[model samples]
Target chain A: MAEKSSELKLLSAWFSPMALRAKIALNIKGLEYENVEEDFNSKSHLLLRSNPVHKKVPVLIHGEKSICESSIIVQYIDEVWSNNNAPSILPQHAYDSAIARFWVSYIDEKLFVCAKNIQDAGKSDEEKKPHSEQLEEEMLVRLEEAFNKCSDKKPFFGGNNIGLIDIALGSFLPVLGLIEEINGRMVLVEDKFPGLINWAVNFAANPAVAGTFPEIDKLILFGKTLLKKMGYCL
Target chain B: MAEKSSELKLLSAWFSPMALRAKIALNIKGLEYENVEEDFNSKSHLLLRSNPVHKKVPVLIHGEKSICESSIIVQYIDEVWSNNNAPSILPQHAYDSAIARFWVSYIDEKLFVCAKNIQDAGKSDEEKKPHSEQLEEEMLVRLEEAFNKCSDKKPFFGGNNIGLIDIALGSFLPVLGLIEEINGRMVLVEDKFPGLINWAVNFAANPAVAGTFPEIDKLILFGKTLLKKMGYCL
Candidate 1:
């Protein structure tokens, strides 16, 4: 077994779901790491050097090597730690693993697009309202379809255990909630998607996720202020 | 070692790079399989039943189990046949494996977007000329950057050997070349991106890719007629 590293370091920013996913994955795996927060406005040279291609946060630096992309980082963590002591983030069975990965890919392709639109809506001028709303509606519909496909028996995506799907979806929940609160619109209404709502509740309740989630109030206030400045406020 | 099946089945379409990746992977691995051509317009019940969610192709139905998603299916092939007399597609080193996976993800996200735009342009009407041209330009720029990033290396994305990155990118070359030829545009010019051009040429020279690649002349003619009907062609 490769000796567990005590010198794992994370380059991250507060309120970034991508970074939060990496943090949560590390915590779940019982890996100890120093968290280095990077300013989005004035990104650190380390972050830039670590991920020159994307220069995005949620870069996991282990000793000498750095891994970028949230999902990629999560997979790296799972592969490095071997997922023995920690909960298995990937499905045990190969087929189930494929399914989990499929959903994760779907989340990246579909759900994230909607989330980006909503974020952009709050960041764009009044003229972008039509485009933003169109994107939001499209995303919500897709989310509804995705939620419908889930069986209530599985609290998490992989039947009773939080796996890759949960992490993928959970990472976006904080931002979704913040966006809704700022916009005064409930995108993921509990009444509309009870199962998804319950899933979110249970996911957020997980110690690994709940412990490190960003401050919701801070995110909401920041989002609202940004929206107002962009002339897209309620 | 698991016995290799006498007859393998590939569920795929003509224009899908996702399907093409699987085809190339199987060929590189030197596995002989029965090709099951699928019509995208009216998908066969088998394709739908096998992959209900996406209902898309490149679904490799080995003996009993079915695998969907080009990247996942490729990994599945590499894993199941690890001990067999197949060419090793993935890198042995974990970091290299991660890098290979990263490029695969990049192809799916960035390269696929460009391919989609080019396809959409060829399928649109005359009024959509501006949209098509803009998409073409965007794809060219993105492809240029992608080529530049990989140009420092050898003919392939993984240095000398044709690895997963080559498989991923090669699958799209036929379609990209077809689009460029039909549109009378030089999206992937030799002088502009010689490395990428060389990579594509080497990929096409591969018996696996070259053998299974769709005929560009036929595809170009088909695209022209389709675009003309859609009012896109002059």
Candidate 2:
């Protein structure tokens, strides 16, 4: 029955998938929240005050509480809006939820950081090639296994619903696509990983997540500007 | 009223604080489980098969299911044994649980790892000095903040009971002492972090965790042997 709150705000950066996870979670919860975009170089006072631990983006503020860590924020949103119309983001079953949580934890713990490093490696950056390739291959292998293990009949990871695992992976979709675009490689090839490719396609087109992603061209251009700003690319 | 499982096995290592988390969880739950210790130099078949993602120890096998990730396994234990007569390891309230999780996550994500690197950097290793020093100071500052924020009147992070946060940090007690012994610096000095030090002492003396830790001198010797084997020390 908790459809709305007096004050719900998200401190985020447009370019971050981590931030996108919070936005997408809010959108899915059917809850109205103000999204305040942040500049990394000159972080806002609210951002610094709210998130002293990591000083990171995607800090969710609910009433007087400030929740950092995007995954935790999503969980908070799900819990606070437990009576919302949407199906439980993390399934009701404990085991199933744990599995969903494991995959979500896997995103930042291993997958996303590796993917970012791999995507950031310059085309002619020979020194970084093998390291990036190794991580990418390992990531793909795990993704392929998870894809095969989850339902092929259903459109999402949790079967018949876009559950927590779906949101966790779905948030990273734009970045995955951006990496593929920048690196000019078919990271999610149909022949090699048909199940994953199918899942990605379904996820990208899904209403909850689809609108959240920027156009591939726009994402690529934005990525370039961001990287240039960081002095990682010229 | 289920007191135990017929087929509960813990795949773990003696040296790993991560492994100890699972052991401590099992103990606190009062559920009978077998401890199958693994040799780190040559991991057992079950360790590899059960945890293909990390291929690490502390994988809990219950009936036919295998649960990996120390914290995840602990969470699973708490859920599966929810009926057991022990108080919840993670706090019951959502915000409280989130705060507990935040601290637990901070241990591995920042504090423990930085402390390890700082402890491992040899006295003559001038190249590693500045980085280790910076990370150590930041970690200490953060620890002080978390300690002060989580508890003032109680000995544990959850205020009286050894909750998830306590277990997470308690497992690192021996290693912390060992780190100080090696580096010859009192990272947990009473004046600097009195709250954490108090919690650490109370945790070590508490029956729940006391039985879980090795003797201080024995642990020191073990740490030396392990570091020597790994070429981290002479």
RMSD of each: 4.9, 2.7
lDDT of 2 by residue, B1-234 (tens): 544556799988777788888888887777778889887678898888888888877888988888888888888888878877887888877777778787788887876766566556454557546645755577766766777777667878877777888888888777877777866777678887778888888888877676777677887887767766665421
Instruction: Give each candidate's interface RMSD in Å.
Output: 1.4, 1.2
Best by TM-score: 2
Cα deviation of A97, candidate 2, in Å: 2.5
Q: Return the TM-score for candidate 2, rounded to 2 decimals.
A: 0.92
List each candidate's DockQ score. 0.43, 0.60
Report the C-alpha lDDT of model 1 over A35-82, residue by residue, as the tens digit: 898876688999999887678888988878888888889888888787
Runs in model 2 lying further than 4 Å from the true structure: A1-6, A121-124, A231-234, B1-5, B121-124, B131-136, B231-234
Clashing pairs in 2: none
